[model samples]
Target: MSSKVSLLISIILHAGVAFAQGPAFERTPLFILEKNRNPENIMVIYTQLDSECRVQKKRGGSEKVVFDFYWLMKRKDFKQVNPIIKKEIRSRLELLPSNDTHSFSVMMNDLKELDTDIKDFKLIVTANKKKGNCVTESILKLGESDQNKKVKLESIYAESKGFLIPTVISVTVNGIDAETGAKVTRKYMKK
Candidate 1:
């Protein structure tokens, strides 16, 4: 009996390497706006995905695949004022305001002139290899501000260098308010 078929092929190769080492999928949190409550006006975003690369395609035959994700981001914010909720949260985050009651006092004086440490924002992603055609990138480093009331953005950092064959790195967090642009809390990271 060939030693029970070599112990059933070594127990099916150790159960397929324990299911390929498991744990590598489950990320959700891709918002542009929609969460609010008010905690000195809130905003916290954090993300980190290093060295991930992937590519696959069958073309017109079906079974599609195409993903390119490189990531990094640590953005924070807190603002409280009211100039009509800081002109509708700077027109829905498009920012760019030099008037209108100084737009939350120039974004809470640029989060009190940042530099408490942790600073560097940049994240690039391109998807279509399944998983809802993802697309998210927004980690501004407070390069401009001056319309006042009360604003706070506490963190920022992002980096990437992994592309060409196996990608899946995602992290997301959100909280915004200058008065009422909404979205006060959000989180996502699992992969």
Candidate 2:
């Protein structure tokens, strides 16, 4: 076989392997309050709804929202993943009958206490309900240099996506707002 043929065969095999590994996971961004501040030490905010408490407008019913927040760090080998700052909120959904969706901002508090000097890590937020589980994950890259950046929070929506079926629960991690800061409380009403 010629040298060119062998090279082409090797390239094809590598491409196949890459495709088999699967596409990258989508990440939501966490807004950092101050520039040049350490991402781990600073306050980061994202929006999420109560997993149990969602208003299914199309279908009239009750929804249960359970919020679970975890911090996933890729180990040195890159294959191993570990969880940190694992918190489970037992709060129930304050339901509203007439609303189509429920949205709110969630603040990630007490990150400095983790005690691990990780330059970067992934934030995974999971909402579990009677219908199904919904998850929103984001990667936070904290480098050694002071980049002096501020992260802004934006609204995100989750849908049941079924015609006859109602959404069990939907949580939107609205991005952090530097001006308003983390919301202390939110109210949901019923139809």
> Model 1: residues >4 Å from true position, as ranges?
1-83, 86-88, 91-112, 118-129, 135-191
What TM-score do all the candidates reach, one by one?
0.20, 0.20
TM-score of candidate 1 versus the correct structure, residues matched by position: 0.20
How far residue 98's Cα lies from its native spot in candidate 2, in Å, is 12
Residues 99-185, candidate 1: write the lDDT tens digits: 221011112122222232213221222222224232222222212232221212222211112443212122232323335444333
Most lDDT-accurate candidate: 2
lDDT for each candidate structure: 0.25, 0.26
For candidate 2, the per-residue lDDT at 153 reads: 25
- Give stretches of model 2 more than 4 Å off: 1-66, 74-85, 88-102, 105-151, 154-191
lDDT value, residue 85 of candidate 1 = 45
Model 2 lDDT-worst window of ten:
17-26
